[model samples]
Target: MFAARPYEDVLMDDIAQQAGVSRALLYRHFPSKHALFAAVYQQAADRLLAETKLDPTDSLVGQLVQGMDIHLDYFVANRHAVLAANRVLAGDPVIQTIMTGELDALRARLLAVLPLADESARRTVSAVLKSWLVFVQILVVDWLTEQTCSRTELRDICVGAVLGALRPLLPADLVPNWPQLAAGRAGA
Candidate 1:
């Protein structure tokens, strides 16, 4: 129900009917609509994170591309839910916490796979990634609404942005080859 309709337009009774459960049971589990949305959003986040595998065998670029693709797929599918979380529930603490947790988990996964110079470099790169992820959220959310560019272009833009931001910070030898970056995404 949350995925198919705008947050404001969805009613508790409708959700109960859709679930084939009594309104009393629905309210028992999730006291309110906001609570239900939060739970659903968290479940979606968990699924996305699980699907985006950060394998050590793959190139960093490949993992990045895969992660972005999985997320973009979800964002495109659940457009309304995302808008509600990012716009309508933007100020809500629970929703914000869920977003923060997902970002932190992703950052941790990237850090695990990233070729950092040392602990100092890891710290710096972590901070940079934090900023980059937040930028991605804001930009992608806006893109969902306005759609100023193609999805492929938007994906490339995000991939390019992070690579650009990390280029100067990363050691030369540690950096992935840029020329062939886009040509072979899965192997890159």
Candidate 2:
């Protein structure tokens, strides 16, 4: 119910009716409509993290592509919920924390896969990953609203973007042969 309809349109009474429970029982569990929305959004975030399987054998690019595909799939399917969470409840700390937690977990996975030279590199790459994740969130949320580009193009742009952001932070030796960079160099 929350995923399909705008958050403002989803009443506690309706949620209770859909769940085959009375308003009393629903309030006992969630307390309020905002609380209910938070629970649903948290479940979605947890499921996304679980589904984004990162194969250690795959290259960084491959892993990013896989992650983006999974996320994009969710975003497309739950556009209304995502928009409500991002726009309607933008000021909600609980909602923001869920978003941050998911992004931080993703950053840790990316840091694990990066070929960093030392603690300094790890820290630098972690910062870059943090910013890139936020960038993706904003861009993708905007895309959900306007759909200015194809889903595949959006995914590719996200993957390409993080790669571009990380290129400067990584060691010089690692940059030249990085998959997309290599392809780009050949063309240049």
Candidate 3:
């Protein structure tokens, strides 16, 4: 329903009818449409986070590329659900909080792997990672909805965006292997 129409336009009666449940039953389970959307978003976010966990043994670039792959895969596989979630982003505080919290967890995981010299450097890297993640979400939504780019191309673009952000902050040794890492090899 979200893929076909905006969440605001999807009536609770329509949802209950589609689910073959009585309105009373639906309301019993979810007091409001916002509650239902929040439940859906939380489930999807938790699943994605679990599925895309970073490998501690992989190089930073490799881990990033793999994580991008996981995200793109999930988005593609659950296009309807993802689109629905995106449409409801403005309606509910609980849903927004769930989305933000998941993104923050992802940022923290990536920051842990990045090599930084001090608290200030870590802060800078974390900020860059968070900003790039927003870009990733937007781009992923666009790519999946528009079918403008191949999956591999989209993944490469995401990897490039992150690597570009980290270039000046990362060491020379760690900088050269980004492309290779995107191709499924670890950087030295």
Candidate 4:
């Protein structure tokens, strides 16, 4: 309903009617519309993370590809929901805190997988990976709305960009196979 209607017009009564529940019941669960929106946003984020199931045993590049695929798939599937969430969360401090915390957790998990030689290197690699991921996400959103390229083609572009950006930070052996794996993804 949030996606279908303007946020200001999506009242508790609208949600209650849509859900076939009483307004009182809905309010009992979510004190305000903002709370309900936040809940939905958090649920979507959690669902996206759960669907990815990043494997620790996989190579870093492989894991990154899988993660990006999952992220792109989610955005493609739930573009409106994502847009609604973003709209509702814009300029909201509580939502911003929640998003930041979730991202920090994701960063910690990714940092665990990267083989950094020292604390400084680990921090540098983590920052680079975080920035790369954000860039890829923006690209994915643009691709989702534009549909200028097929998912396979977009995946190849993303993989290439990610691998190129990480070449200096990643192991030498891993860097060489990045392009090969990306190119061969259609076959696999």
Candidate 5:
């Protein structure tokens, strides 16, 4: 139902019938449609997070570039679910809380791998990391709507944005060889 119609148009009865379950059974598991939607959103979000995880062997730059591709691919494949999740995100406090938690987890993961010299630089990088996460989401949504650039172009731009934003805060020794590390890449 969600695939064919907007989230608001999906009725509990339709879901129950499609799932070969009674409405009472469905309600027993998910008290409301909003709850059921949130559960699905959680699964999608988890998949996104899983895909975005950094490979332990990759450099910081490599991780960033890889994550950009993973993020964009997920958006491209799950556009409808992403749209519905975004709507639920705006109107539902429970979903909002779950997203906040996911953001915090992402932040923690970035901080763990990001190379900064001191607590002060780490704090600054942390802020930049969070802001860049939000920027990626906004840029992808806009790109999906406008088709202003190809996916490769979008990935290049996003990776460049993240590296450029963090360059000043990162230690000189920690900086990767941009031209060599991500050579022939659109953003590199």
Candidate 6:
């Protein structure tokens, strides 16, 4: 019931009535509406994170494409819930901390898969990856709102852009494969 209703509309009485429980009982579990809303946001974040799988064997570009696809899939499928969580967490310090930690963990996971030879290269790659991830997020949100293209088409464009940017940074073997991928994607 809470999930279906807007956070502001989910009064204790409404939840209690929906659950066939007294208001006091609901209060016993969650002290306030904000606490209950936070719990819902945390659960949603956890579920979304669990749904994202990273393949260790894939190249950095491949892994990024996979991650982007998963992210877009989640956003497309759960737009309302995600937008609700975004609104609730936007100004919440505790939620910001959690979000930062989650992003750091994801960065570390990607770093683990990337082949950085030197400290400078590692730092440079990390910065690029972080920026690229944010760019992808913004692009996805814009694409969603505009309905400018199919998700697969948007994904291809995003993937192509990132791969093009990373080409100079990658080894010869990887560099050659990118053009082929770009050509294949374009032809599709």
Question: Local error of candidate 3 at 61, Å?
Answer: 2.2
lDDT of 2 by residue, 1-188 (tens): 87788888989999899889999999999989999899999999999999998877787777887899899999989998999989999899999999999999999988887678899888989998999999999999999999899887788778778877887887654333455564563477
Estimated TM-score per prediction? 0.93, 0.90, 0.83, 0.82, 0.85, 0.77
Q: If the candidates were sorted by their TM-score against the true structure, best first, what order would they fall in?
A: 1, 2, 5, 3, 4, 6
Task: Name the regions of candidate 3 deviating beyond 4 angstroms.
Answer: 1-21, 177-188
Clashing pairs in 6: none
Question: Going through the candidates in order, what is the number of backbone clashes in each?
Answer: 0, 0, 0, 0, 0, 0
7-82 in candidate 5: lDDT tens per residue? Answer: 7788999999999999999999999988888888788678778878876567777787777777777778767656
- Residue pairs in steric clash, candidate 5? none
lDDT tens per residue, model 1, 60-130: 67778889989999999999999999999999999999999999999999999877778998999999999
- What stretches of model 4 exceed 4 Å from their correct place? 2-11
Q: What's the CA error at residue 177 for candidate 5, in Å? A: 7.4
What tens digits encode model 4's per-residue C-alpha lDDT throughout 24-142? 99999999998998887788777776776667688766776787778777776676655555554557886766666666666777888767789988888788767766677567667
Q: List the lowest-lDDT window of 10 residues for candidate 4.
A: 81-90
Pull out the clashing pairs in model 2: none
- The count of residue-pair clashes in candidate 2 stands at 0
TM-score of 6: 0.77
Q: Residue 66 CA error for candidate 3 (Å)?
A: 1.7
Write the residue-wise lDDT of candidate 6 on 49-126 in tens digits: 676667767666677677778878877776644555556456787666655665666677777776768888888777
TM-score for candidate 2:
0.90
Task: Report the poorest 10 consecutive residues by lDDT, candidate 6.
Answer: 80-89
For all the candidates, what are their Cα RMSDs to the real structure? 2.3, 3.3, 3.4, 2.6, 2.7, 3.1
